[model samples]
Target chain A: MKLTIPGEELMGHGNLSCQGCGGSLAMRYALKALGRDTIAVIPACCWSIIDGPFPYSCLKIPVFHTAFETAASAASGVSAAMKIKGKKTTVLAWAGDGGTFDIGIQALSGAAERGDNIIYICYDNEAYMNTGIQRSSATPYGAWTTTTPAKKFKSAPKKNMVEIMVAHKIPYTATACIAYPEDFIKKIKKAKGFQGTKYIQVLAPCPTGWRYDPAKTIELSKMAVESGIYPLYEVENGIYKISRKAKNKTVKEYIKMQGRFSHLTGEVIDEMQKNVDKEWELLIRKEEFYGHTKE
Target chain B: MKKVVTGNYAASYGAKVSRAEVVAAYPITPQTQIVEKIASFVANNEMDAEYIKVESEHSAMAACVGASAAGCRAYTATSAQGLALMHEMLHWAANARLPVVMANVNRAMGPPWTVWTDQNDSLSQRDTGWLQFYCENSQEVFDTTIQAYKICEKIGLPGMLVLDAFILSHTSEPVEIYDQDRIDKFLPKYNPRYKLEPSETHAFGGLTTPEWYYELRYKIQSAMDEGLKEIESVGKDFGKMFGRKYGLIEKYRCDDIDTLLVMSGSTASTGKEVIDRLRDNGERIGLARMRVFRPFPKQEMRKLAEDVNKIIVIDRNISFGNEGIFFSELKSALYNENTDIPVYGFIAGLGGRDITMKDIEGMIKKADGKPKDIIWWGLK
Candidate 1:
């Protein structure tokens, strides 16, 4: 069965996000998948500014702009309150990487553990783009972010947030990308079909933060997946299925498009490449193991 | 029906009668009974509400903020550290203009942790844009808590119904209970003008640019001003229905008095005794009880101290560098009123230290007919 993306537009044009902002497009696609019968709980992030100021919201759906680190708990509350009203409102916890992987993890974990009937989507642009591109836990190893200057670049690997969510034993968890809108929208629609906690971490690129050209946002997202830097996959009830397989592009091809990684030496690049290959193999073994068991 | 219940139980009953749709709370001493009673109410199916037994005080308030924003009558209760821990969400609930009513069983802040009653816990949260009401008794606790829903819902601002820790929270008193059906007529179901509904999509608590941020906060302040104006009138209607009044300030025999001694919470009843005894002894003294702490109750403070020669405030909370918090607040309220009454700030209770009628009398005696600094009353 072919899943068609909804033609309905919940996000309006001329919003505040920087040009070619992948996080902005992720929201547009997310709203399309969920449609208008939704309430969005947004924490402080790039999307906070992207959703225009008060009295001039860009989203057509009702939005609840929350504190810096309360998207999940707020969505949990919104959904709980809606249940009492007997309204079928899809509450969306839309946040950025900083709000998700760092400050918001506590609230997110609490909500997930409780198995709240809400969908929490973190449109990760890697660094803290809203606060001037500081290095976040989601920032890749050897990448140059504002806080992690070229001297002592981000040496930590990108946090495996999908594994974290899967460990919560949630009903659904997935990784999506802007380059794969159909797959992204399909996974979101699938999440909506589930009753308990659903988390989708989308790899959205920031043109300004990632030091890439405005036109290369989709290209970067595509390369990130093709290089196994960010593979698209879904984990449902302990079963894993690779949504998009890597095309075997080197990490060099992926990093060449962005200036954030331009400062890396050949030795450092090899170290990063080794880590990525190891990560990809681990991911494949899990998919093979879980996928085999399911079959 | 009437029942002998603790003030905490009274708060739990109040939420039930209000038909609160969502309640999220964590347990702390004194305040534990309030949440436990609420949990039992939900467990027994006495209340048709979502009782989210959250992991912590922070999540408890966060859940309530979500519930309230989603257009439900939300309620919670806490004391001291729990209240302090819930501080961030408290600001969010108020700023979002979600009418989330909370009952804070006032307790002393910790160092050498104690569960005794004091005002510092709530007083420290003065500027969170939440309306505050201190109950003088368990009966008032029940009535005022219900009134708090009406108060917050009317103005679209959050409010707290405060009662003393063990003195009221743990101690039982006879409280008149009104059935849900009867209470429903007085306080109808919350009809939100705007909510988290796709039926009428709108952005709430959005990121306002500085160009518009000031006005949005100004609107909150304007709502506060409107709340102050509407409180007494709402109390009148509540009294007409329930035979109990919830005013900004509960004054006891303050008319035509020379020396006015002011206090809040359960201490009002004890202070009133001291006032009566002093009056019988031919001393012109009266007790002024602070009911609503936020919105400042400036008009009432000015009126209470209008004819008095001296005003002595016995605060259970301190402001660190400044005088007693209530003393500072009341003093500021009378600053522009042009009243030359020598207002004295007396720090009487801190860290669960017992405050009694004799201690209040000592505060009155220590007032040296001068606008002096805060005197640490009863300090050895």
Candidate 2:
């Protein structure tokens, strides 16, 4: 099937985001895939600020900047309204990790359970970047945020949001990253085709918050996938398909690229590797259970 | 079309006539039937709206906010715990200035977990910057719901039309449903002056520095202050179109009265009946039904309270450990005014108990003399 990526820039230039802000890039790519008919339900995140002040916005699409936790519900509403008007417009909820994993979980779960026709995309930069890089549930274990300093790095593992979304038996759920623009665009276009609730988790790396070289943002994301730290996969109708399977690389390669994880010692690094390996094992099991490898 | 409907049905019917684009709601007691009827309307294609069956009340409001922001009129109904669950998003819908209309069936919040009628749920969100209107009867419930959209859009604020749970939500009465064509003329299609449009570049709910934060908040306040006039104008227009005039405060037989009974919601109907009986008996007792609660009709309330030798406030909701919520606001409104009459606060019909005309008579009798800090009525 030929991919029909939007050629027009619905999200225009001159945004207020920092250079190489992953969240802004995520929105731009998402708009390119979803098109001008897409309505973005933005929660309280950096994108809310990046959208620019009132009477001045960067995006050319209709954006409803809702509360911190209301993106999912708001998207559901917009979808319903479109259905009412007999308009086949896509309602996309663009939120950050803090909005998705923490405050917005309830609304997200509700929308997912009801199978409300919406596309919920979470740009996972790992922390609440808008609130001064505070640790969120999406923050990886052993990562250091302002709230969880080097002395007291995050102890809890990052919540498995894609699995949770798949558990709702939604039409589509996928993981994408900025490093793989084609794959990211492909997944978004595929998501647009699905009928019911569709969710996309994009691993958007923030240079300022992650304390990495702004130019290396895409490189870090690529390393994150190659090192098996952030595997790219898609779940459709309970079937899991590993979209990108990279050669196994050292977790240290992914960690050392960002200062947030610089505090991890050998033991903590090993622990992180063990956790990633265990999660990968589970994904492989799911793939085996659902995808059924060709003979 | 006309029907003998309950206040809840009236609200639902009003929403139906308004051609609400989306109806997102979760079922809670008292308010369940309101959404049930709305759902049936959508399911039957009687109303062209998407009836979103959300998991919780919080999402219900969130969905309405989304629909409104998408440049479509949206509505939802909830009571008590459902309203409490929607507390945080209520502020969001208001601040985002989405002209979403919600009908809050006033019920007490839970601790022991009661679903009875009380004003605590809506009153608790007094500072949320949404326009709040209380209804006295099925007619008002139906009329106010239609009028709220106009007021909300005019002031760029969301509106909450509240009716007492059980007392108003379930009770049946006479309500005239207007023709859809007439309603269309009265409430033209919602054309939001400012909305999220891809063709136009504009931001919403963005970061505000200290320099602009206060100004934005003051703008909201100024809009609210101007809303009073807008509300009155809509009320008059609605009356002229629909033959039902509602105001910030609806006065009853207050002329040449020495004592007045101040109340809101269904209980005001009871107060009116009692006031009529007392007037017939040659007692100088009158009734003041407060229609608009938030943007608290302060000046009008004070002017109305000035001539009365004694003022009695009947509140169906309490603030717990303090006087009645409405009473406190009333007292604040009358504070420093030249009213010599001693103000009395009477808490009544808590936990959804029926407030009869006899209860109003008792409250009127008690108000003839100085009463305690807060007198609890219908406790037995």
In order, the TM-score of chain B in each prediction is 0.98, 0.96
Output the chain A TM-score of model 1.
Answer: 0.97
Best by lDDT: 1
lDDT of 2 at A170: 95
Q: After aligning candidate 2 to the native by TM-score, how far in Å is the CA of B362 from where it should be? A: 3.1
Assess each prediction's global lDDT (C-alpha) against the native: 0.88, 0.86
lDDT of 2 by residue, A72-184 (tens): 99889888877767788888889999999998998899899988899999999999998899999999999999999999999998999988998999999999998888889
Q: What is the lDDT of residue B192 in candidate 2?
A: 88
RMSD score of candidate 2 (Å):
2.8
**Candidate 1 structure quality by residue, lDDT tens digits, B1-380:** 99999999999999999999999888898899888998999999999998877777888888899899888999999999999988999999988898899999998888778888788889888899999998889999999878888888999999998999888888898999987777898889998888888877788877667988788789999999888877898898888887876678887888778888888888889899999899999898888899888888888888777788888888888888888988888888888984577988888777767887778777788887557868888888
- After TM-score superposition, the amount by which residue B363's alpha carbon in candidate 1 deviates from its true location, in angstroms, is 2.0
Candidate 1 docking DockQ? 0.73
